[model samples]
Target: MERHCVFVTIFVLILHLVQAQNQTGFISVDCGLSPPESPYNAPQTGLTYTSDTGLINTGKTGRIAKDFEPFVDKPALTMRYFPDGIRNCYNLNVTRDTNYLIKATFVYGNYDGLNVDPNFDLYLGPNLWTTICLVKTGISIPFINVLELRPLKKNVYATQSGSLKYLFRMYVSNSSRRIRSVKMGQNHGSTQLNSTHEP
Candidate 1:
């Protein structure tokens, strides 16, 4: 009987991903903003920056330091810039056996002044999420990370595996490297960052 209707359609899609994994999945994206607005007096509450509308692949939007006070009040997300290619994505609408609290932020206000400080390679769909080395000490050096997602299916492809971590964070820096302040806890269980180097 067609293998019992393919095992009853994979058990009704894993029982609709366990009833949509207990209803509570908030996704905030402010990657490379430009004409994409939603964050100015939001301080931070289910953050939103849907420029290019849930981008999945497309690039070329750079801006750096223009009265930039570390993104003032989150100036629509660090003034704006998404300079990386070949695998740039932002298609978040997850819920397939869910468990998420994914927060991704990046700011490199050197913007191409060639002060250069880049290292990018973060993905969740094709799974290899984490490799952002932006420690250029001229100012904008905020590369926040706090991802805890355990989705086994239903679209997971965030690929940026090369660019040599932006020339290895603009040829490495060591002024005693110190700027680590990212505290996000409430554990969703399933977070791993075996230190691929970050400061």
Candidate 2:
């Protein structure tokens, strides 16, 4: 009986070690969330996300309109908006020369009830990463919903200088039967090349 108990403890320890290794180099942030509602696991992705309160000093917290709440994931329901300041940035601690995949999600669900899209710029360490023009109508505001970072393998996607910006990703089957595309910044705009696929 004692030997059996020892074996069970060893199995449990191995399981805990595997789980910790899987979550080692990952950071997920849900902007605009406070203490009580901060740390929660996303229902869709099954990933734990923490509040971004300590990472950024600027920006005001706001929730999306009631009508659009059901259309987005839990992380995208609230946002951090920057109305003032020429440049607002989030501070993250990352390894010096490690490659990381950074993803920022933006969902303009009429959070301000203005029914107008926002336009702004995104920068990465003093470099202009991209111009975030939600619509062509010319609006002015900056907001973010979710931000995630994952460490990548050293030999994968090696660049000569600067960093890589994520735009979009697609998966194609071997038979070219179906294609699935996921565009960053727009979480509700995924497209799949199947009749029954829903966005």
Please report the candidate that would top TM-score against the real structure: 2
Q: TM-scores, in order shown? A: 0.26, 0.67
Residue by residue across 22-71, what tens digits does model 1's lDDT show? Answer: 42354444445544354322443323333433444444455556654464
Which portions of model 1 miss their true places by more than 4 Å? 15-27, 34-102, 105-199
**Residue pairs with clashing backbones, model 1:** 118-166, 119-165, 119-166, 123-158, 125-156, 125-157
How accurate locally, in lDDT, is each candidate? 0.40, 0.67
Best by lDDT: 2
Could you give me the TM-score of model 2 versus the true structure?
0.67
- What tens-digit string does per-residue lDDT give for candidate 2 at 1-199? 9999999999988866755456567788898988688788787666788998888888789999998888789999988888767667787767767777877787878888886545555544432322122121124678889888888889988888645655453433223334333333422231111111122
Task: Give lDDT: candidate 2, residue 107.
Answer: 80
Clashing pairs in 2: none
